[model samples]
Target chain A: MDILRLIIAGSVDNGKSTLMGRLLYDSKSVMQDQLEAMEKHSRSQAAGCPDLALLTDGLRAEREQGITIDVAYKYFSTTRRKFILADAPGHVQYTRNMVTGCSNSDLAVIMVDARHGLVEQTNRHTLIASMLGVPHLVVAINKMDLVDYAQERFEQITSEFSKLTQGYTFQTLTFIPMCALQGDNVVQPSTHMPWYQGPTLLRFLEQVEVRRHTNLSEARFPVQYVIRQQTSPDYRGYAGKIISGSYRKGDVVRVLPVGMESVISAVEVGGQKVEEACAPRSVVLRLADSVEVKRGDVIVKPDSLPTTTQELEVMLCWLDNKPLLSGNNYLLQLNSSVVQARVGQVAYRVNVTTLRQEPAPEHVAQNDVVKTTLHTDSPLPHDAYTCLRENGGAILIDKTNLATVGACMIQ
Target chain B: MGTHTLDYLEELESEAIHILREVAGQCERPALLFSGGKDSIVLVHLALKAFRPGTFPFPLLHIDTGHNFQETLDFRDQLVERIGERLIVRHVEDTIQAKALTEPSGRFASRNTLQIHTLLDAIQEFSLDACIGGARRDEEKARAKERVFSVRDAAGQWNPNLQRPELWSTYNGRVQKGQHVRVFPISNWTELDVWEYIQREGIEVPALYFAHEREVVEQQGQLMATSGLFPQGAAAAIRRRVRYRTIGDMTCTAAVPSEAATVAAVIQELLATRVSERGATRLDDQLSEAAMEDRKLKGYF
Candidate 1:
């Protein structure tokens, strides 16, 4: 089954976990024993109702504070689809966790309360989702039941959200009024939501054209492992997963910055010869003849090869307690390749909620997103992160603390 | 899944194979952490599949808890024999006897936590830089934060806040000496994916995961199987129609009431069941929210 990697985001207590729990419960994904346990715990805590929010909110700190502290992953499946739901904490203090959850999501469901209309956190999440290049966005206006299940109330909230998020670029943008507490327009279509003609949240997820998100422009394979026979003579081959595009046997490809073109002699995996490989699948690619290919060596179509640059201008999301100092060398990771990159130019810092750029500061603080320049020791072969989402981005780690201080989307 | 899509099942396999290769090429002296469980069984398959015809680049290492299901031990040995690969086992009981660790206090106490001491000691002993695990992200909340090439300090502690940004297919496997990496090749895979792949590839798994009759004690919601050494009171009783959710020390790992004798039925039940694989059986995780986090920090890959 094709597992849909979905990120659930909304302001605190906007029913993010409740909605997820409802989905799991109604779908029969939660088992009899687990449900019994949840119910038992529920009866011990509250009155009659089992708080579905208890499902993803696993931490005791969260239970005490009644808020999600970290990103909790919940798995549930329908015969039609498997869902990898990453439920992230929405507190501003934990925005870093939220960013991590939305990083690789296929779709982001930003919930809005019908009563509250639009909040700052909702905008921040929507902005982050769009900025991360997540193709689909669903504005789930939850708690329609609170507003007497009014269709007009749903439209008002939807219209208000649209005015602000209109500039956001997304392949699929939808609005579904739901009540996670009451199971309306969540799993089954709500009779109350007859005015809403669109498919329910689950159906929309199943029908969303994921094919449009796949990039088939050209093949880009980053070598993760180099295989060699341990028992025999130096039997060497470069092994890695294909990030994007495809490669087949006998296809001529370039060995990146070395620019040595060679034909793929074999795609040997498990002693069997495979015809080709595509994005995200790891495979061993054999060259017709031996070449000096090792770890971090990228393989791509010679014609569509990304430019190798020493100076990188990227949008950085600073995530650390200490400020980023100029000229400090950090571990720069792009794909499977890791190289030492020095802080070159500290461009103006961009506000998280607003895209407005301010004058460059001497020190970049925690949770600050800045557009900066990176000068690497070696030429980094990659495209603008926007074009090749995979190759174009890099995460900078503080070599000292070993914390991922910043993530960059190469412009 | 799509014309452009790699088969959903095959996609996970390819991703795993890619990661295994990455470890071999990047780390100086890496080892595959084989537990002989279906997850690790799948790992062995992926590693073998990763480097076909040619022998695997790295050695296989097992942290023998001493307390284990005999079926698992048999399968582990059988797998090593079949693949003709070297395996280095460092015993938890031996580690405890060596004064490196201490035995826990109660009937619920398991050597699962003590596996870390042996694992870390083994790493230092072998001078292995990267330890490959079959830990899937979907297994736990803390694991959900894992990077494919997770770097650990000299103490083998994981700092999630400092995880390397894994973008697209690029995995940065570079790490400092003494600061080895913990690579989870199957980080994205779910329990169902493992079963489907096992069925498709016809990979051999320990028979314990399948339905079987066994002696057990239901304590704190986990069906504890009688390992004979624990010396349980009359509370422990034998039961039938049981399958192991996860293969670990027979004492800590629970057996769910399952009739899913075949892999397909297991997959079907897993799809329908709401209790997660670990939630159903993992005794160690029930200890605390930071349980896995603490062990991971200690470099228990």
Candidate 2:
């Protein structure tokens, strides 16, 4: 079976956790012992029915506050396919957590309450999802039962969501009316809505194709480790997972940043020799000639090499409580390479909800996205985020505290 | 099929190898926690593939509870010898005598909890910057929230609230002095996936995992193997074919009634089993709702 990674994003009280619980419950993924434990805890709290949110709220503090604070991952599989769900918190302050969840996801499910149509939180999440390049979006209009399952309410929300998607880039967009509390159009078709003809949420998820999203036309391999034999001095290999494209045994490749050309003498995966290997496969390649190569070095096809430079223009999202000040030095880590870097200029801050640009901000606060430029101490090989995600995305860590403070996408 | 695609097992193997290589490249001083269990055995296999034709950058560290089954100890020694790697074993008995850690006394008394002190002491003694473990998120609730690279404070305590946001495949391996990170390579794998991989890779495990006719005694509705440290009483021991799903201290690990003598049969049984691997075999986890969480907070692997 194949695995589909997805993120659930929404505002507070939009029933994100409830929808997850219903999916697991309806699919029979919840085991007997886990259900019993939830039941026992519910009775102690005098809750008549088991709180579905308790299923995803694994932390004690989350249960106490009745809200999710961190990204909680859940796994379940049906006969058709398997799923890895990242449940992101909904509060405005936790936007960084949502970004963390969406970074690796192939799809995003945005929930909105039907009674209060479109809100700022919805706009913010949708924009972030687009910025992260999430290919698929499912705008689930939740709590339809509260609105008497009215067709007008669902259409109004969908039309409003359409207005927001006018400037965003999404490969696929879907809208579904759901009542997570009552299990309406979540796992099974809702009898109450005869006018709406669409697949249930579970059905859409099961049938969605998780195609390879990595760049396959240009071969890129970042050397993670060097394997050398002590007794036999002739044995040497460069081991890493291929980020994009394919490599064959006799292909000529160039070592990046140093620009040394070498021929691939052999390719091996799991200790067996293979003629060819492709993206996402961890393998070791033996070069015909001895060349100086180590970790943080990229090996790519000579014709499709990435740009190597010390100056970078990027769109960065501030992730730490400490404000990012211009001219402050930080560590820029991309792929396996780490180097000293400083923020050069703050171009503008983009208002995620209103889509307005504020020029010349003094400092970027937490959860704020800005367009900026950076100067690195050393030159590094990178691609535009619009071209290749693996080579374009990077994170900035504080030199003093070693905390990941910002996420940058090379523009 | 015209397009080349990897199966589920192959994909899982690739991911694990990537994680192991990341630890070797990033961490200054790293060690693999080997317990002679099936999961740890798989981890070792992946480490070998990650850097073959050369010795591992990190050594194997084992915390011996001294209540181990003889089969497990023998298996650990032979595997280390075959791989030609260094092994460091620290005994809980030594820590118990030095630190005056009280041992539980009763029919259900186990030295499992006491192993934490020895593990922490080993981490301090070796100055290991990263400890690679085989813990899976599907095992318990608290484990489900753990990051691929989980950080620990100077005092070896885990604060769930202060966990770093792990995005994409980028792991923040930066740590201060006297601090370390615990890396779980198989955090995304399920129990069934482990068994299937073990079978595919042809990895060797302790004999206790296979069904055998052994003398056993039923206590608190769990079957205890009479072969190891358990004291045999006057009551005649019952002989039944059983297999172990998890291997820990001999006193804490329980056996289930089964006829799975081979790896294929074990996979078949796993498909039909409803209870989780830890739920059926571990007595320590059944103590409370937050049993694993509490142990992890105090630096338990």
**Best by TM-score, which number?**
2
**Model 2, which residues run further than 4 Å from truth?**
A43-49, A61-69, A231-233, B1-3, B227-237
Name the DockQ score for candidate 1. Answer: 0.45
Over A26-121, each residue of candidate 1 has an lDDT whose tens digit, in order, gives 877666655655676574466666778766646443455463334556776677777778776666445566666777788999989889888777
Task: Give the whole-model CA lDDT for all candidates, comma-separated.
Answer: 0.77, 0.85
Model 2 CA lDDT for position A303:
85
Looking at candidate 1, what is the lDDT of residue B261?
89
Query: Tens-digit lDDT track for model 2 on A125-178?
Result: 898898887889999999999999999999988998998899887888999999
> What does each candidate score in C-alpha RMSD?
3.2, 2.4
Clashing residue pairs in all predictions, respectively, total: 16, 0
lDDT accuracy of residue A237 in candidate 1: 73
DockQ of model 2, rounded to 2 decimals: 0.56
